[model samples]
Target: MEWLMYVSVAIIAIAFAVLVFYIIQTLLSLKKTMENISHTVDGMKSQVDEISKESTQLLHKTNELTEDLQYKSNTLNSVFHAAEDLGHSFQKLNGSLRKVSETVSKQADDNAEDVAKAVKWGSVVMSFWQKWKTEKTTKQADPGKEAN
Candidate 1:
């Protein structure tokens, strides 16, 4: 009976040792897995920070572009306004010219008959002067014949 009791005690001790060894192995594996997870999180955090910085810079550039476009648009607006003013000035000048031309045309039409009578009087006066000059020259050439 003493030998059987010793054998049973030794068997129980061996089983307990086996269970403790397996537990230690499992804890070591869990530790390694946790360390890998920590490293992956750190890498992800750095990448996210880089992305945030780039986004901020991109936003600033976009704002500058918007301001430049606004300035150009304002400048173009002035040019368009100046062109419109010039067009109006041209229109006014054209209207004045048209009025002056119409007045001149009307006056010419009203005085057509008067202009024709003046031309006829000028032609008659020129004819009389030529005839007097020719007679004086003929009389000077022949003094005796001129007395008649």
Candidate 2:
């Protein structure tokens, strides 16, 4: 009986020792894994911070580009309007020029016969004036000259 009691006590002691050893090993492993997880989480946080800063800069750049584009678009719109106005002015000038050209052409057509008659009369009058002047000058040189 005493031997049985001693053996039972020894067995119980061995089991408790094994259980304590495994518990300590598991706890240490869990602690190490937790530390590794903490380090990984800290690295991820730093990367996230860098990404946020880049994102903010990108947003600012995008805003600046948008504003610049708007300004250029406005300038282009005014230029387009100016071009349209220029086209209208050209159209009006062309119409006025055509009217003046048509009037000139019509006047020329109506006066063609009158212009010809006037030129013929002018030539006849010039010849008569030349003959009269020569005859008077000769008469003045001689005392009495009859222009036959």
Candidate 3:
């Protein structure tokens, strides 16, 4: 009876030792997993910081581009306004030219009858002068007839 009790006590002690050893190994494995997680978190933090810096640069570039576009649009607006002004000037000039052309046409039409009457009078005067000169030449050559 005493020997059996000793053997039973030894068996319980061995089982307890085995349990403690497995628990320690499990704890070690958990510690290693925690360390890996910490390293991964550090790496992610660095990547996040790099991404933040790059995003900041990108934002600055976008703002610069926006300003440049605004400036160019303003310049284009001025050019469009100039073109509109030029178009208006041309329209006014064309209107003035049309009025002048109409006035000239009206004047020509009004003077047409007067011009015809003046031409007839000038023709009559020239014919009379030519007849008088011819008679004078004939009288001078004949010397017997007096020219009245």
Candidate 4:
């Protein structure tokens, strides 16, 4: 009976030791896993910070681009307005030229007969002046004798 009691105690002690070893091993594994997770979380935090900075820069650049586009669009609007004004001016000039041309045409049409009559009167006066000059020269050249 004394040997049986010692064997039972020994068995119980061995079982308890095995259980404690396994518990310690489990705790160590859990600690290692927790450390890995902490490192991963830190890495993720750094990546997030970098991404946040990049996104902020991207947003600022986008705003600047939007402002530049708006300014260029405004400038283009003025150019369009200038083009429209030039077109209007050209149209007005064309209209004025057309009106002047039409007036000249109308005046020429109204004065065509008067112009022809004036040309005919000019020709008749020139013929009379030429004939008078020739007669006077002939009389002067033959002053000593009567001219036939």
lDDT against the true structure, per candidate, is 0.94, 0.97, 0.97, 0.98
Runs in model 4 with CA error above 4 Å? 1-20, 119-148
Model 3 off-target regions past 4 Å? 1-12, 112-148
Give the per-residue lDDT of model 3 (tens digit) for 24-119: 999999999999999999999999999999999999999999999999999999999999999999999999999999999999899989989999
Q: Write the per-residue lDDT of candidate 4 for residues 1-148, one digit (tens) a residue.
A: 9999999999999999999999999999999999999999999999999999999999999999999999999999999999999999999999999999999999999999999999999999999999999988988888966644
Per residue, candidate 1 scores C-alpha lDDT tens digits across 1-148 of 9999999998898888998899889999999999999999999999999999999999999999999999999999999999999999999999999999999999999998999999899899899989999989999999999667
Model 2 reaches what TM-score against the true structure? Answer: 0.64
Model 3 gets an lDDT of 0.97
- Residue 131 C-alpha lDDT in model 3: 100
User: Weakest 10 consecutive residues, lDDT, candidate 4?
Assistant: 139-148
| lDDT, model 2 | 0.97
Ranking by lDDT: 4, 3, 2, 1
TM-score-best of 1 and 3: 3
Off by over 4 Å in 1: 1-36, 119-148
lDDT winner between candidates 1 and 2: 2
